[model samples]
Target: MGRHREYDVDKVLDATLCVFWRKGYEGTSYADLTEAAGVERPALYSAFGNKEALFRRVLDRYQERFMNHIPEALGMPTAREAARHILFSSVELNTRSPEQAGCLGINGSVAGSDESEPVRQALIDFRAAGETQLRERFVRAKAEGDLPPHANPEALAAFLMAVMHGMAVQAKAGFSREMLEAVAEQALSAVPGGGAAPA
Candidate 1:
């Protein structure tokens, strides 16, 4: 029979997630993970497999815990509101935790060695999925006349994502919340009817 885990799996994953968030996959090592998770190498391997596998599991947890705002934002009444929600929420999230500032997905694998290509691609695909969701939501907004007919849903979605990504990088660099908020506000100008609402 398999032995029962002496450690809490969720706690280990959370600690590991913070480590991954602060340092990219390639930047992190088994020693770092073990130190953060407070678990032995053998136990971590038994519970979550190799480094790549453990990162993937933590990535899933990040989505479940932190990315819920995206879906909620997408459901807003207007595309502008949806974009605004995502932007502001991102600002809050990116700077909320001082020890782990920035986004897990973006910080996870933006750049890495050839051996980490699969992990990098996984992060890319994960981000692309969010962009696709925004694009679809904007398309619906266009159809509903919430957005101008001339406004390109695809471009708008991409633009919003770019702004969010930039904000994440800025947050990692220690940009203040107010500064990020200003950035988010300025980005709204590009959205059709974005300036119509009072800030």
Candidate 2:
């Protein structure tokens, strides 16, 4: 072998994700990433090129590790229950861990700019995909008699996504899990079925 790699790529990506999740894209410096990832600046640059490239790696990893659950959540029995699980799980993901708080994609929004078109588009696509999935779930729920016949599945999905993102932003602002749950409860309560909503 030419040289032995001193750092683990998986571990470094995990740590980098945590750092970005906590400090956000712009807030995290190269030094912060190096230190948090337990690698020197040169190593980080060698591995990832720059902060933007590194964040793309982190975001990609986060999508696979965390956000891929969206499809499964949508596949559940009822849209309302799926909505509840998605929101509550997001709250748990954001607040239950000390290593990172908030979502990487949501945090990415803070640093997103027109110049960062790829990153911004990725986040937008993530949100749109989520909204579409939620809409499908709502459509299925309505067909199954779990929701009112007149409910607009697409609009309801968009609404639930709004609630999810709002809660994620609030969680990033130091909201507690219980508080976020109450937020979820209130949002769910506003649905047509109240607490009896299925999913």
Candidate 3:
């Protein structure tokens, strides 16, 4: 009989996320993954197929671990509160991690082109889903008369998305958590009547 596999699949994928998050998909190699994951190359190939397949798995796992909770954060009592939480959480995510990979969605996707169409599309889809969730929250706020009747939920969502991606880029450039928090505070201040603006 063949030798039994020893490592956990979820653990391996989690490690793979760090490798790809820090290096990007194209930047990471088989040796990089193997070393980071502490798994043999043969085991990795057996479990994840190829490099692209492994990267996709890593993305999916990351989404499950990180992205899925975003909607819950947006479920705060008010739309503005939810937006603040999302922004602050993103800043925290980038700064708190020792890996300093930036936002995987922003760094990996924005850097990719037609040659990396599949990965790029995956990132776009993830962002679109996030925007949709944010828009719905804004729509609920508008219905509650918390926002101006003319406020467009879709536009607000798009603007927030842009701001988020900008933060991700800046974080990758080594901006500190304090700087990111200041940016978030300014963005939050721009929201109409969200209490007193930061001093």
Number of the top-ranking candidate, with TM-score as the measure: 1
Per-residue accuracy of model 2 over 105-167 as CA lDDT, tens digit each: 788777656666766776788678778777877877888788888788888887777888887
lDDT of 3 by residue, 1-199 (tens): 4878899998899888888888777677789999989999999989899887887888888788877548776767766777788888888877777575478877667445565787778778878988988888888788887766888888888988888899988888889899999999898886654532222
The lDDT for every candidate, in the order shown, is 0.89, 0.79, 0.80
User: Candidate 1, which segments miss by more than 4 Å at Cα?
Assistant: 194-199
Instruction: Kindly provide the TM-score of model 3 when superposed on the true structure, using C-alpha atoms.
Output: 0.89
lDDT of 1 by residue, 1-199 (tens): 4877789999999999999999978889999999999999999998999999999999999999989899899878788888889999999999998878889887886665788998999999999999999999989888877788898999999999999999999999999999999999999877895523322
Q: Give the Å error, residue 184, model 3.
A: 0.4
lDDT of 1 at 183: 99
Q: How do all the candidates rank in terms of TM-score, highest first?
A: 1, 3, 2
Ranking by lDDT: 1, 3, 2
On lDDT, the leading prediction is 1
Better of 2 and 3 by lDDT: 3
